[model samples]
Structures are given as C-alpha cells and as structure tokens.
Target: MSNDVAILGVGMHKWGKWGKNFVEYGVKACLDALKDAGIEWTDVDFVSGADTVRNGYPGYVAGATFAQALGWTGARVASSYAACASGATGMNAARAQILAGMADVALVIGADTTPKGFLAPTSGDRPDDPDWLRFRLLGAANPTYFGLYARRRMELYGATEKDFAKVKVKNAAHGFKNSYARYNKKFTEEEVLNSPMVSDPLRLFEICATSDGAAAVVLTSMDFARKHTANPIKIAAISTVTPTYPNTVIEMPNFATDSSAVVGLPDAPFRDSIAKAAYEEAGLGPEDLDLAEVYDLSSALELDWYENIGLCKEGEAERLLNDGETTMGGRVPVNPSGGLACFGEAVPAQAISQVCELTWQLRGAAGERQVKGAKVGLTVNQGLFGHGSSVIVTK
Candidate 1:
C-alpha cells in the first residue's frame, strides 16, 4: 500500500453530555476539522462516517445523514461499522481512497451517544448472537472480560493491582491537561483501589466510562498536503486486521476460549497481531515509535498493550511501568494522550481521537502533555467481535 496519505487536520467535539444529537456533535467536529485543515466543506471530495447504533432506523445510514447535515455537497459517501474500531476503519477507508486517487481530500467522522449502565447487547434474545449469549449465559459485562485479562496477567506475570493503579495514575495526570477528557480529575492510587468494584480485581475507577463524544479528521494525498502545509503529519500505515482461528486468547463477551480443543492458537495473541501488521506495513518496529495511544478500556488492558505492542517483553510491562518508561518524558512513552483510562470510551469516536492526539503531538502542538521530540507515533485499538485497528503516524 502506498504511504502517501497525509492528515491535514483533526478535531473533536468536547466530550461529555451536551444533550445534543449525534448528528450535531458530528457536524461540529466535521466543521472544526475542516477549519483546522484550512479547507472548506465543499472542497472535500469524499466523506466517511463511523456508524453508531441509533435509537431508531436513522443510525444505519450515517454517511448520508452526516453529509445531508453538512448541506449535501454530494461527496462520495461511505459508512463503516466495526463496533469500537469503527473510527479507525473509517480512517482506513478515507486513507485508501486518497491513496487510490479516488479522492484527493476526504472527511472522516465518528460520534456516539451511548446508553447508560452496562453496555447491553442489541435488544432481543437471539441465541445465535454471541453478544446476547455472553450476556445471558455468562453475565459477563465488559468488565468481566477485563477482569479475566487482569487475572491472567496476575497469574502469568505477577502484575499487581498496584501496577494497574499506576496506569490510572499516569493517564489521569495526563488527562488532567486534556480539555476534551471526560474525567479531568486525577485519581490517587488509594482512590483507585478504593473505588467500587465492577468486576473482580477491577474497580469503577480502573474501568473506562462510556462517554458521548465526536472526532473527525481531514485526510488528503501527500501531494495535496505539501501544497497546503509544509510539514503535514503523514499516515504511514493503517492496519484493519482480523484474528486467526484457534484464537485461544479469550476475548470479550465470549463464554469460552477459542477451543484449543481443535488447534493450537498462534504464539502471538490477536491483539499483538494487529500492531504487528501495522508495524510490518509501515516498515518500522515498536522501537521506532516515539509514543503510542492505545485503548485502555481498563487499566489492566493498558499493561497488556505494553507487551502486545512489543514495547516490552511478556510480563515485563509492570517493570516498565515501575521504571516510568511508559509515562511522558520516558523512553518510548505509551498513551501520552491519557488513553481511554482518562478519556473514557467514546466507541466509534475513540480510535479517530487517538489519531487526533497523534497529529497534535507530531505537529508539536500538544501543550504540556506532549512527548518531547516525538517523530513517530502509533495508535492501537481492538474492537469487540474481531475487529482490530492500528495506525502509524510520522512527521
């Protein structure tokens, strides 16, 4: 694939309950991205949207809805749905179009108004639906899966709840500077440890909150970017990969592991595979990354990402955390944008928001929270039900 896509601009609607419709949030973010790119909405040749589950039938055709809301410029429109990975997938589509010469400039948008309480499966008890089955049979809220992973890490690597708390502490400090973060308040280790338990070994503070937010990006061909700005941060790779079978790594909302009963799972877990694909495509390794923005739905998940992204060896993530290696001003920092631990889960908007943070860091515009002298950045996230996303950005 051509590494010729450049991010001209990125924007986000301030996260939190604004009591507005998803379309309004999306339009605001879209317009902000256009303004940031110094381009007009009419100048975009195509638009891609990350689909959100609507209260009614209106959610399915997100691209058309967003386009119409923006005055129907009749730009080539596409909508993508990949659960939490929807935003990254939307970005992947926009970049592909730019690389294929299908469109010189494209708009990528994702926004969501999430439901309260546990993120329930779609209504109706369809036995065939794994999401429903997991909920019904296992009573596994998302936190249960997070608990399983955290427990596994404890068993395999001896990572303590304190290590996980460090993640929350670090990210919360960073989030304190992020105006868009839903939870701007910092948490102490004692506070994190004392928070109400959502699942075994994971407390409410340890888990990311469901948030309402929107994010958008303006992508263009490298040629177009060069004409518009001298130093546009370019997207080196976008990995929208899936898992291999016998995926023994137990994922969310699944009652049983991929039957090692049939075939042995690959040595690398599916999560690592996502980052590997992006690293391979970018012709760079994790060592080359100046910073990373990963999905930290739970604090334990952040530790897992440190190893999965090859920033550290297996079970060594805690050591890295203790060494302050993953914090800002440390070697090859991870989640300098505060991650979902601080930002919370905006679902469709989260992955795009990761890139938005990377763009700011690469442009040397991230005040205070910036990773000093960052040249290459990576964003990694896994969507439930087998969707994976990883993107590499370089100055």
Candidate 2:
C-alpha cells in the first residue's frame, strides 16, 4: 500500500476522572479534530472508534455511538477492540480504508472512563480465558506482572530501584509541561522511592493509574491532504502483530507461559517483533527516529521498551536512562508527552493520544515539550491477548 496517508488534525479531551458520559468526551474530541482539519462533519466519508468494554452496551457499538453523538452524516462507520492497543487498531482500520480508495477522509476516535483500580475480568464463566482465571484464582493484578518484570530486570540486568525511580522523575517532568496530561505534578526520586509499594518490586509512583480520556484524529489520502495543507504529516507505517508459538514471556493475567524447553523460543520476542515490523515497513531504524512514545505501564517497562525498540543495546537501557537520554531534550527522546505515567492507562484512548503527541511534535506545536527539529516519531503499545501495535509518523 502507499505510505502517504496524512494526518490532517489531532485533538483530545482533557484526561482525568470526569464523571461524564464517554460519548461526550468522544464527540468533543472529534469536533475539535474536525475543526482543526477545517472540515465539516458532512465532509468526513467514514469514521472509526476504538471500542470500550468498561462502559455498557454503548461501548460495544462505538462507531455508531460516536456517529449518533456527532449528528450522523450517513458516514460509513467501524469499531475495533484490542485492549490497550485498541485505539491504534482503530487507527489502522481508518488508514486501511483510506488507502483502499474506499474513503477520501476518515475520523478515528477512542475514549474510556477508567475504573477506580486495576481492571477486572469481564468474563462470567470462561475458565479457558487466561485473564479471567488468573484474577479469579490468584488475585494477581496487573501490577504483580509489572513487579515480576521489574524484579527480573534487577536480577538479570543489574538494574536498581534508583534506576526505576529515575524514570518516574523523568516522565513527571514532561507530564508537567503537557496541558492535556492528567497528572501534571512533577515527581522526585526520593518521592517515588518512598512511595508505597503496590507489588513486590514496583511502587505506586512508578506505576501508571487508570484514567478517563478521549482522543481523535482526521486522516486523508495524500492527494486530498495536498489541497488542504502544505505541511502534511504522513502515517508512514502501522504494525499490528501477534506473538509466535511457544511464547515464553509471562504476560498479564496469565497463570503461566508456553513451554520453550522442547519446542524452543521464537527468533524474535513478541515486543521486539512488534517494533521490527514497523521499522521494516517504514524502512527506518532507531537511528533515524527523532523520538518515540511507548507503553510505559511502569517505569521499568519503559526501560524494557528502550531495548525492545532498538534505542540501545539490550543491557544498555539503564545506562541510557542514567545518562539523561530518554528525557524531553535528549538524543532520541522517549515519552516526551509524559506517556502512561502522566495520563495513565486510558486504554482505548491512549494510543490515539500518542499519535496526537507525535503530530504536535512534528508540527513544532508542542510548547515546552517539543523535541526540536523532530522529523520522525514512533509509538509502541501492546494490549493483552497478543495484540501488538507500532505506528510511525513523519513530517
């Protein structure tokens, strides 16, 4: 397919615990995007929404939900559900539709009203579903899985609690600069280290919270974009991949992992494979990237992504962080928009917001947090159940 689909506009509703309808958040963000694109609702040929499961039946019919909220211009509609990667999955749907000549322009949206604490399993009696069984039997929340990874890093990679604390400090600094961020207060290493521990190795400050937020983007074919604006940012590549067999990594809400002693592990791990696909499609590598926004579920997870996304050698992530490279103005800055640490896991809306940050940075409109001369940006996030996403955007 062509690599010239352009993002005409990006918008978001302020992320927080707003006790309002998800429709309100979604429509506001959509209208903001439409206004930014200088297009009317009637101009949109199609629309797509990232499905939310936390809400009631309306969550399931996300596309129709948003369309009805936005006054229904008889636009073709679609929806997708991919856990935390849901928004990116929806974005891929819109991009694919535009590339196929099915629509000249598309509006993509995602929003969620996060529950108080860890998200619980929605299944009633599905014993086979790992998510349901793990929580039911062990009461092991998502943070427990993050703790496991953090501990593993300490043992295997000589990472320290200080290393993890450093991440909270860095992300908070950037978050403080973003007006759309939910938690704008800056954090310190002492504060993060002294914070209560939710799990064995991970602390409260190092982990992200659940949030309510919404984001939307307007996309169009390269030809259509040319007539609208001269400096159109292109969606260069979108990678939505799944894991290979005998996946040895222990993911969230799962009892165990695949046995790899006999069958052996895949050539590339799940996270690595996700980013490799994007790089191959974009014909670029870490060296070419100006910045990246990754799924920083925990501070340690950000370090893991630094390696997974090829920012540095496998064992060099901690050094990368200690040397001040992952901060806002560093070489190949990561999470310049504060990431999940600032905005928390809004899930469906999170990935869409990542692209929004990239759009702003590329446009040189990210005041205070802008990475100077940013030309290419990448966003990497994964949902449970083998959903992986990596989208590359370029000016």
Candidate 1 global CA lDDT score = 0.88
Would you estimate the TM-scores of all the predictions?
0.98, 0.98
Candidate 1: tens digits of C-alpha lDDT, residues 64-152: 88899998887999999998999989999998888878999999999888776678888886999988998888888899999989999
State the C-alpha lDDT per candidate: 0.88, 0.91
Which 10 consecutive positions of candidate 1 have the poorest summed lDDT? 54-63
- The residue ranges of model 1 lying beyond 4 angstroms of the native Cα positions read none
Which pairs of residues clash in candidate 2, taking residues 3 or more apart in a chain or in different chains?
none
lDDT accuracy of residue 83 in candidate 2: 94
